[model samples]
Target: MVDFTFNAKEQEIIREIRREGLVLRKYARYYDEHEEELPPDEFPEAKEFAHIDKMAADRGADATSPTAFYMCMLMHRTWGDMMRMKVPFTALGNASVTAAGTDEQKKRWAKTRLSMANTEPGCGSDSKAIETTAELDGDEWVLNGEKIFVTTGIRAEGSVIWATIDKSAGRGGIKAFVVMKGTPGFELVKKEKKMGIRSSDTAAFVLKNCRVPKENLLGMDPTVKKGGGGFKGLMKTFNLTRPGVAAMGIGNIMACQEFVAEEMAKEGVAVDYEAGQHKRSAIQQKMIELEAELEAATLCTLRAGWLADKGKPNNLEASVSKQKGGDISRRGAQLALEILGAMGSTHDQLVEKWFRDARITDIYEGTGEIQRLVIARELLNYTSKDLT
Candidate 1:
């Protein structure tokens, strides 16, 4: 029942997309080196490919698997370059809003690209410790907080800011609100200097008595429910994106392998599958191991994405894929550099950049430790409190 390969229509579209991706790959290094400058919203070459989507009108139902194919495409994107070429890149907040927002809130901000504002100066891995506060006053909700490491923070039309309505209520008091960028009392503090993914903007913000209509509250109800309130409802958005983060790792993995393999090929080294270990050189042995790891991690990602497409719970699977993808890509890039030696670290090649870029895929969606904890709790049927 599981098909690993895409249908023919999907295949056709993927090929064309990759064809264009190769063109963008030319600018990867340019953006990587100039981390301070955000990639242009639209490349001048975009005009040539403007009709790419409409060209897919005749695709069959076999190509309709959205989440699964999307994972495949994410890998393809990273394979081309870590610096993305898409204009007006989609924001992480958009997914959260779709998952937890009131129907009216969704309709109101249908076109707004929203970045997620969850991390605070003090809060990184443990989202439950968020210090941002939200209070309802008359027709508006007053929000006061500082957000850091906000992805797409500079380019997002708005942000889905998370704040606790009552810290005493614990996680139950946390909720999300839609705050437009130009809203009074909302200030862009500064952009972050990063080791990788520089083309994508990361920024910080300060909200001092920032007020938005009370209706902008996601999920509409702010009374700290018996549980962590709307906190769990908002966190559920990661069920799909965790696999997405893994897919990014998969892309880097594929790139790392290909780069090393090509370098080996130039030196007249071809990987021989049938050879015994004793006959294989040390480099050949490592190549085989890297290939095996890449295959395993990719399978884990595909399974997680497929589960999402089926409307099934993928919490355990998502964490598994995320950890696998994160670990492999990080290691693979390092191994690739080791194989290439001095030339690898030099800006002459991209392996060094991959080493830097591959790091975040694991850390952001959730740390490796968090993923392992999720896996443990799921296996033991333990709630958060029980596991902690």
Candidate 2:
């Protein structure tokens, strides 16, 4: 029988994660203000909670199910801070490697920390317009270009960089290459000062004739096919990642909701869900509306993740989740601040920081506009060229 309620084991895991989140919240303000302090990999307080894997193993959870409990844990973690606690071994480039790398390539790069480089000065949402070039030079591939807004570039051991082998072929010629840090010509140009998620490192890099072994070419096929096979293969990584990105936005929205609810309750104003919308106060009605939107966006993200876990195609669903999550987060944050009055705009409270952090969700992992384009293309059964 299908069960929607959490089992005892799942409840225990949730409780533990929430407890860890409370501990992590203590540092959220400090990091937001300092922006230079990196949170330690494992806090002393984290030792009290059972390791997440061990908890799952104890419960004998099905590893292949479409129901992603990990998404819940991520939501809870991000509830404390949008940057969350950075765990090792998981990076954006890891998704690229899993989607496009060969078995040998995966094993070889397993221990290396990797960041993804896709955006350039001229290219943001339109990835096909990337100007980075990768030229074959005998046994080496020479990379030359600049990449901006790399998420973990400051500390990552290597990067999965997108570059075109032939500019005339557009995305068909785009290929991902693994370039380790400390490569002779590769340089970390500068770390960007960001408006939000300040705890996380953002960097810009320059590659001037950066050379790596030909084997470093991801997927091992350098040929530009007629239908953009290379581009599609790389983009498949988004099928899994877009949902996670949406979940992060949902997390931020939930955090803001919880904060507003607590502050309102203190002022003797409460959200009575049983009451009709016409009877409730304006604040109550607004809170209810935000709650409904959050639920809808959360459901979209869960559906997309579930489809991916089931090994089903989820391109349309992923875009839907990203689009909704991004819009909802931005709106939710703005509403939460509006409801709080002038206090919400003050740096003394984390709600203001959340408002700043929430803006990035709609901009990254493909902008909301780009996701809308993808959704429209899918629904109309048209190619990107046919619609855009």
lDDT, candidate 1, 1-388, per-residue tens: 7677777877877777677677777888898888888788877687776665664555676664567777877788688776666754567888888879888877877788999999999987788889999999999999999999999999899999999999888788889998998999899999988998888889999999999999889989968877775887887878878888898888877888998899999999999989999999999999999999988888888888888889888899999999998899788888898889998898888788888998888799788889999999999999888886
Worst lDDT 10-window in candidate 1: 50-59
Candidate 1 lDDT at 121 equals: 91
**Which residue pairs in candidate 2 have backbone atoms (N, alpha carbon, C) closer than 3 angstroms, thus clashing?**
none
lDDT of 2 by residue, 1-388 (tens): 2233556787777777777777777878887888776666666676676486578556545332434566666677788778876465668888899889999999988888889999999998889999999999999999999999998888788999999999999989999999999999999998888899888888899999999999999999989967899999899988878888888888888999999999999999999999887889999999999999998888788778777777889999999999998999899999999999999999888899999999998998999999999999999999988987
In terms of lDDT, the best-performing candidate is 2
TM-score of each: 0.96, 0.96
Error of 1 at 259 (Å): 1.3
The deviation in Å at residue 23 for candidate 2 is 0.5
lDDT of each: 0.85, 0.86
Reference-based lDDT, residue 382, model 1: 95
Any idea what lDDT model 1 has? Answer: 0.85
